[model samples]
Target chain A: MSLRPYLTAFGLQWKIGLRYRIAVVAGLVAQMWFGAVTLMAYASVYHAAPDVQAPLSLRQAMTYTWIQQSLFTLLPLGCLPAIGDAARTGAIVYDLLRPVDMWNWWLSASLARLLGNAVPRAVLLACVAGPLAILVGLGAWSLAGPASLISAALALLSITLGALLSATIVMWWNILTARTLSPLGSYAVGTPLAVLLSGMLLPLPLYPDWVRPFLLAQPFAGITDIPIRIYLGTFIPGGVATGLGLQIFWLTALTLLGRLWMRQTVNRLEVQGA
Target chain B: MTQSPSHTLSGPGLYRRMAGASIVAQLRYPGTFVIQAIGNFVTTLLSFFGIWSLFHRFGSIAGWDIGTVAVLYGLVNVAFAVAETLGRGFEVFGGEYVRTGSFDRLLLRPRSTLLLLLGHELRLRPIGRFLQGLFVLVAGLWLAPHVQWSAVLVLPWAIAGGAAMFLGVLIGQAALCFITVEGLEVVNVLTYGGVEAGQYPLTMFGRWLRRFITFVLPLAAVCYYPTLFSLAHPDPLGMPTWIGALSPAAGFAFLGVMILAWNRAVAGYVSSGS
Candidate 1:
């Protein structure tokens, strides 16, 4: 199939996602506020237990909170809003009848939407939380950069993969919306799952020893936790290679399974007449 | 086709009858209803698990144990859940009512607009969050070593105040829709963000943040102070114990102010329209 249709889908979605400049700014402020609160909580916790050998230092944890908060909108928190609307109005049947590869079409749109929402806010927030805060005499509390040049480079690469993995997961949610013919199910299932498992709620390293590995291995962790860990130059057990490998593994695995699921869902989609 | 004005119901009576109708409509789709409720339960449960795991790793955070924090967590969740259940109409008013001009239909009714809105608010889906929160509250109370008969008596009052405060936030959000339909997403910072902040002890936040939530939003008044009062825990910041019991009044006062603001906003909208 020619790539033009998929590219058109991507461009359209990218523009729609960027149209909400006000939302980006507002979301930035909200995320910043929550990030600061989480940082202060971590500061108090770490200070109170100075004797304990925590996995991530206070500064690392603070930085983690900053990055996570800045990228809060990046996660696939629910089905595509467009798809949800389509489902509600019975317009989704047209989506399936389109003359293009369904998976690639939705995948391109999903990725564009995620990046479009996340990129501007991430850049704006990093400036305010990192350099601006330091210049304004809040240096100690400002978000720190990568541990080194190498870490920064690797983190950049890992984060790209992480974004792809996140978009792929959103495809599953999209298909779920198609099957249920309701967007609410995807959101009801998506929000808390992503928030908890992605280490947005708490740093996965902070969990108990028994649960740490499970948290680390989850697909959602690959979305942000691993990339953030790489940026912090924290140990990733096997190495940076292993961390990158885990992300690629999940990406490919999810894409294969998701495509199959999408095929089955589309085959069975039955729109009811009013 | 003469309408009988004498048949009009009182505010509470109208609310009960309309709310009962909404519940029956929701119950018509049992499968969707159960899925939503279960999904709600699981999502909130995951966040609780995040907290539980953190406490498991470190015995206490800043002298606040899992049980102590759980009291704050449960109280906030329970209150927020109640608000979410009963204020669902106001919560979606901007998108559903104002944007579509269906709010005019509400204004044409013989009943008070507030009662009509309240009648639309009694959603059953939030029963999931309520049940989960109750489980945690009971566990927290059981594990907390302190015992006071007054604590039991104070719980319901605090929950009521917290619920009202959150409902006020939702109402304020709806009122803002009359001014600007876009960028209202920032209000999530108050509703969802407040719950996150309230889950932890007040002292864990910075001085300014603590002041904001106390004086500006008064979430700490409805959630934190009342929690401390019931737990019989000394405020780490050294406020008198009686303040905890009395502080819930701040929440109710805040709600009254929001209602006044909402009325002013409605008047503005009416004047600006045909």
Candidate 2:
């Protein structure tokens, strides 16, 4: 298939995502604040009981939190605002009329928006949380580098898959909005599920050992947790390959299932106005 | 109409009726509401579980155990949920009212803007966060080693104060919208970030953050200070025990200042004047 329409869709949403410079800065500050508080909490917890054989060391957990906070926007928080607006104003019908493949068009936009929102914030936050914290004599709290060059390369690949997996999840929310005729339901359901499961609130490795396997197996874990594991070179159930495999698995499975769901939603959708 | 809004309701009665009607409307979608609430509860509960898991591995963090932390967690969340429910309108004021030019319609009404905004809707979703926090608080109180009988008397006072502080943050955010609606994420740092910060003991934070929350925002003054008092935990941070009772007043004072700021913002607002 031709790539022009999907690229245009991607470009449009990417520009919209990058447009809000102030919001990006604001979100960075908020994430920084959260990261600081979380780091402190971990520090105290780890310090109070140094002898415990915790799954993640204090440094690893801090790094995980910093990266997680930096990539906060990469999580599938809700349906795309454009889709929500379209659904609300009956402009979604025009989206249906567009001559491009609906799934690809929406997926490109979803992926672009997530990248646009996430990339700048992640870079800026990494700089501040990594180098800047160390420069300011807070090296103990800084975001550490990947376990090795191999891990770094693998992490980059994993994060790309992570972002795509996140966008794929957003597609599910988009289809849900199209089905429900309201974006509220998507957010009400999507946010908590994504935040909790994706290790946004806490690193999946830090969770109880019994729960860790189930947490790893979940689709949300593939979005960030698995990639972060690869980055930290932490134990990923079977091995590092298993972490990357999980991301690829979720991305492919979700995309295939999402396309079928989208087709069904569109088949049944009835726009109120002509 | 079955009943004229003006005839049966006036002042606080009207506010109650407004809240009541909104509740009734939400209740119409019982399934949706329940799902959202359960999602919220589980999401928060899982985060707490992360903390529980850590404590399971390590005996305590910074001398405070899970129970004390839970009390702190419960207080801030319950407070935030209450503020979020009541202040949903104010939270969305800039986007829903100012950006849409609906602020003009609100002005056209005879009722006070504060009442109208406060009455917009008592959101049901945060109830999930509230209930989850309450569960943690009760559990924490039971499990904590350092409890006193006076906790029963002091806990409600602290919750009221924390709610006041959060509401103040929301109002301050609404007031800032008068200047620009672009950077509201900065305020989310205070509100959502505040909830995260309040879940831990105040002393655990760095000096700057501890001071900012205690003085500028009073989040710590209301939450951490009172929890310390309730648990009868000695001040690792050097504040006297009696300070908890008086510190909650800071929350109220913060709210008063924010109200004035809101009124000033309204006065300065230049309508489209069509």
- How large is the interface RMSD of each prediction? 1.3, 1.5
Kindly list the per-residue Cα lDDT of model 1 for residues A1-274, writing each as its tens digit. 6999988989998898889889888888799878887888888887877778889888998999999998888898998899888887888878778988889988999999999899899999999999999999998888998999999999999999999999999999999998888888888888888988999989889888888889888899999999999999998889899899999999999999999999888888877445
In order, the first chain's TM-score in every candidate is: 0.98, 0.98
- On a 0 to 1 TM-score scale, where does candidate 1 land against the true structure? 0.96
The CA root-mean-square deviation of candidate 1, after full C-alpha superposition on the true structure, stands at: 2.0
Distance from true location, Cα of A173 in model 2, Å = 1.5
Backbone atom clashes (below 3 Å) for every candidate: 0, 0
TM-scores, one per candidate: 0.96, 0.94
- Residues forming the 10-long window of minimal summed lDDT in candidate 1 chain A: A265-274
Question: Ten-residue segment with the worst summed lDDT in candidate 1 chain B?
Answer: B265-274
Residue A69 displacement (Å), model 1: 1.2
